[model samples]
Target chain A: MTIDALEQRLTDLAFDRPDAGRVTARVLSLARKRRRRAVARLGALAAATLLIAAAVVYFVPAADAVLADTPIAGDLLRSAGLTGAGNRVTAVGAVASSSGFRLQLVGAYADSTRTVLLLRANPAILPLGPPSLDPQLSDQFGRTYHVQSELTDSRTGQVIIEFEALAWPDALTGARIALKVTTLKRACASAPFCTDPVSSEPMVRGSWTLRATVGVDESTPLALPAPAHLGPATFNFTSVRSSLATIGIEMSVKGATFDDLQQRVADGRKGTPVFTIDLFAPNGDTATASYSLGEDQRGPLIQFLGYRFGPGNYRLHISYRGSDVDRLLTVP
Target chain B: MEAALTLSDAATAALTPDELCRRYAPSVCRFAGMIAGSSSDADDLAQDALLRAVRAIHSYDPSKGSPEAWLWRIVVNAGRDSARRRERTRWIVERLAFTAPRESESVEAAVLARLRDADLHAQLRLLPHRDKTLLALRYGVGLDTAEVGAAVGLSTDSTGKAIRRALARLRARLEVTRP
Candidate 1:
């Protein structure tokens, strides 16, 4: 039997549809009963109990990396001045301390258009569950770098964040940058499987002011052939921008109007464009690159893979629903 | 006080419990029914799921998932809870009975009977609860990848990949059992 046949059989099992009206009535009745029960319980408790517990203060020594963990990439360590001869520190206020938690900026590495911040958080207060890291970097010139991705390893409490600095100036010799963090608590001893793991309450919040000097590694942009027209917009292959951690496509969108799209976006009515671009390796293996709206807010934004591809031929496929365009690119 | 009441009423009117039930009760019931196996159990489970969802609505964060996805998750969990509590669950028996045809079965039942057997049924039955719920929610209740992912605690990419893998395994098994 074919896969479609199996799917058909699976779908057919639900043919005898349950009664919506009956179910709804029963649900409403049950809900009303539960609400009444909850209210009655609350009323009974109001008349009976008073309990308080003394707050206790706990302290744990901060975990610091004396020698850079070799598990960290060499390029990252060097860029942050954590490694190499005549190590110059570019990180502003490298360590941020807060109630029951301390986050250290282990290193900061920048390429042509992106920056990666490797941070370690020590949740010394409560038993650590999964933790989330929110890192915000802004320069004195009122330019804020967009955090492209924030990846956290719960086991080690290490966070690797990649932010786009494409819109920043050519040189960041002595720019004062502020980094703010809002850490969320994911797991506690109780209710780990609850619907809202990281709710409104943050585990800890801290901000640091720092002076940063980015040593840029200039990357040559690759030229591409003429634009490929797909649906309403004309897709132009502009350049291949390579950073320390990612390989990306820099392209523009034109011909199709984004006036209405911009309006919807401004009104918070629309997000995440319908189009997607994927990169496929020569051997039929596919790797999907996370994309974001262009820094310039123009067309053909950034479609970048987290890591650089090995020396090989790859196909960049631009697709909208079913229709697509393929471009062969060779990584030198 | 009147203004506050009016605002509260307007908010309640926006997504009333009755409105939510009307919009999603059928799918919820169908999802429960598919997992529960019998009509009576499905009906009871659907009510229980909806009630649980409503009670937890105050805590429902839209940032986490859509309401429908959240409701389906409850149904899936409730179905599993029932299964664990009952030694010989009706759904387990129904799953085995579904494949083998009885005397003078209906036309649809006969069609299914021709396609499935005890061996194939056993393989399908042996699948993990999450896999079964994934298939049921995607096909039986007609939830999209994102919705199914939200319901089953998987990302969209993972959900799509899982469905493909499960389908491939089932197809391969069916091919092996083909007469």
Candidate 2:
């Protein structure tokens, strides 16, 4: 059949129309439950924090020393600065073995915006090189989360996989999460330069599923200033979500058409705008932008990871084409 | 409440979650069904996309594009994710030598079976995921090239070229499958 004929047939196909009211009710119900859970979790965390503080005075030193010895934990401590971030990290100790490989879900550090899962594979799978891991994550609510990026530490054979929820039910606190990995194929022959695996490479073809309960972390939303003017664009700082692990900034840019934004994205695969955002901690430490999560007409949502900002004010400096503006932000 | 009010602008105030679902859920479901090849999968995909849109409604800016384009982008991502999950499950089943029954006979499969165009349906199914998505957006959802490009994060020219290429591939596959 011709393409036009196929298109016509597709348009005429008998597709079932779902009940809009039912769908909307279901969506709203889930959203409400998630919001309620988040609020309740925050309250409980506050109470728990008081109790944990007394307990941590006795146990934190030993715990820190032990974590400092491990390669993955040391890296996490340096990168995310998750030390003593109350209940932000969970120790999952679930293990599954398949096809001569033992995989352990060591633990996870989660905030409002993302979850970083620490997994260790026995037999040192990464000593030779990096491998492509096909992992699928789903929670008790049947909400699936996508893996944004994966970092492997060859020294400990541990994998750090970061997940971002692109839909509702983003709250993972106290929810049962199952992570299933079906295949692990060697993607590269070398350590740093990992390319696609050739067909001849050996592939591990079995399933390893680990389940864990995610701990809660504080995600505080900061009050943003009014829209700022940058040449040819009006940048409205819509929202700023801060947590120990990451800070997410959402803005809407006016006076720039969607085509203009798309062209800028085309010019740079990073898709970041022609501007820079810098976060300066109270201790003179700085955290750089982690990723630019794609921009649309609504503007770009950027994430800054790593650098622990204690309960103090931070300076957010923005620069666009030689013009600079700074805003002081408070982190509770 | 105050934070919500501060976040509200002309773009977000224009459409609430209730209005969005009431107006666009049907079309979203239809588009999802076409891409997922099953009504049941479509239901799940549509719900996921709508809930995502609702939670993220504060980020929607009308000046960026039409609400339809914004929502369709969510739908497209949801569909792609579902497809990846299905592929993984299929891979596991094949590896285990397990004969898992089909989730359900998809609407497209049923219609093609009735019309004795099962070969054409099979050919369509064999197309790459990206090609199928483009075809579904352009033909199944009746989106123009520009709308499809907006949803998929491509330039209009790129979207048009991709759709034409997908059509050509489908035609070639159908020819090969014919007796």
Candidate 3:
């Protein structure tokens, strides 16, 4: 048969279309259940945090001295290792209100490899669950960035969203940043086990825009180790930069093009021969490569969140086609 | 109100839950049915995908593509996850000495009942999973090469080449099977 004929046949395959009204009702009903569950979980977490805070206050007085004015922001910055030197902080205090809610861009923190925006909501627009902010960000150089990770304090409606700056390492310094957010969603508590939002909880719609200029932080590049080989691929580690939120690794892969590697990764998801890279911390904890920014003549840049990787030696593990290689590396 | 909004219109406008269900539910159902190879499973897949889209709507940047493309990407990923889950279940069932029903067997039976091309359907099942997905997106869902690329995370040229290669492979297999 001709391929076109086969296509036509496939298109003609018969199946009964689901009833839209029934599916809608069922989805909305399930969404309500999910929202209620999220709220309950949030309540339990808040109670747990309060108890921990009380105990910490009573037992450890030194912790209070290190906390920023906003405890949530303080904790986030501290965990990200952004409170130390080589980090630049700018106070914007830009505010906007709409749809019965108020939003403020409190400030921004920039390091050599990442930019983090701190935002606060008055009257707590998001439900007592995980908050989802979809803000479109663009810099003066017209380069856009996506949110790499976000942490929200539901009780205070305080949020810290991070973006990778490795693509244009020098462009963020002293650049005007515009952020526009039109809707706020109550995101799923966790991925893969996620559920729909409550039908009653429509996405909060409003236009909130803020502008700020990022300060300069000198980029500090770490020394790279020797190339690691696996099967037919030679991985040359070109550059590694550590920031508060993530460690960016730029490497070139010889003997495999970007598309080939991407296809291999996709096939790996299907129980086939896999290709993966992982970074292990000194404490034996590990973080897998999260996402790729893009590729240039050098190679694709991969990033791993610096959550588990404190100041110590790390082990870089590469697995491909049943072959495994581990090499010791240090992140300064 | 549901009938008044086109898919593109829904993309630029604020998407309500009602609007989302009305504008895209049937298409999503059909697409999910193709991926799942079973109508019953397709309903569940469509529901899961829609639920995810609603919750992750904030991540949808219009500059990336149309809302339809964004939603279909979610559908494709959801289908892949479902397939992996089924594979795991099948592995467990086999270990326990239970006869697991093949997804293709259901597809063959359904095609025999609905269309006059059961042989072709059988051959299609023999193709790799990615090839089947590419075909389903391009032919079954009526997505163009660009939309297929957007959904599957490939460039337009790469998508076109992949689809052509998949078609050639399917044709060779069909010829070998034919009298």
Query: All models: lDDT?
Result: 0.52, 0.59, 0.59
Query: Between which residue pairs do clashes occur in model 1?
Result: A92-A210, A253-A299
Q: TM-score per model for chain B alone? A: 0.64, 0.72, 0.70
Off by over 4 Å in 3: A1-70, A73-92, A123-133, A140-144, A153-155, A164-173, A186-201, A243-246, A263-273, A287-289, A293-310, B1-179
Alpha-carbon runs more than 4 Å astray in model 2: A1-71, A80-87, A125-133, A166-173, A186-202, A258-273, A293-307, B1-179
The residue pairs found clashing in candidate 3 are none
**Candidate 1 lDDT tens digits, A1-332:** 44566677776652454688866865674455311111112223212211100011101111221222435555434323223212232343377666555667765656565666666655412212222344567766778776654444333445556666534453445445556765544322122333223345635444443345456444445557445444445667677754333456767776444442222212254343345566655554453435444535464354454244344566666644222345566654
Residue-level lDDT for A95 in candidate 2:
94
Best by TM-score: 2
At residue B138, candidate 3 shows an lDDT of 86
Model 2: pairs clashing at backbone N, Cα or C within 3 Å: A297-B64
For candidate 2, write residues A92-166 as lDDT tens digits: 889998986677888887776677788776533431112345488888878877765555543345666767642
Docking class of 2: incorrect
DockQ result, candidate 1: 0.20
In terms of DockQ, the best-performing candidate is 1
Off by over 4 Å in 1: A1-70, A73-93, A124-134, A140-142, A166-178, A182-202, A206-213, A231-233, A254-274, A281-288, A293-306, B1-179
Residue A277 alpha-carbon offset, candidate 3, angstroms: 1.8
Ranked by TM-score from best down, the candidates are 2, 3, 1
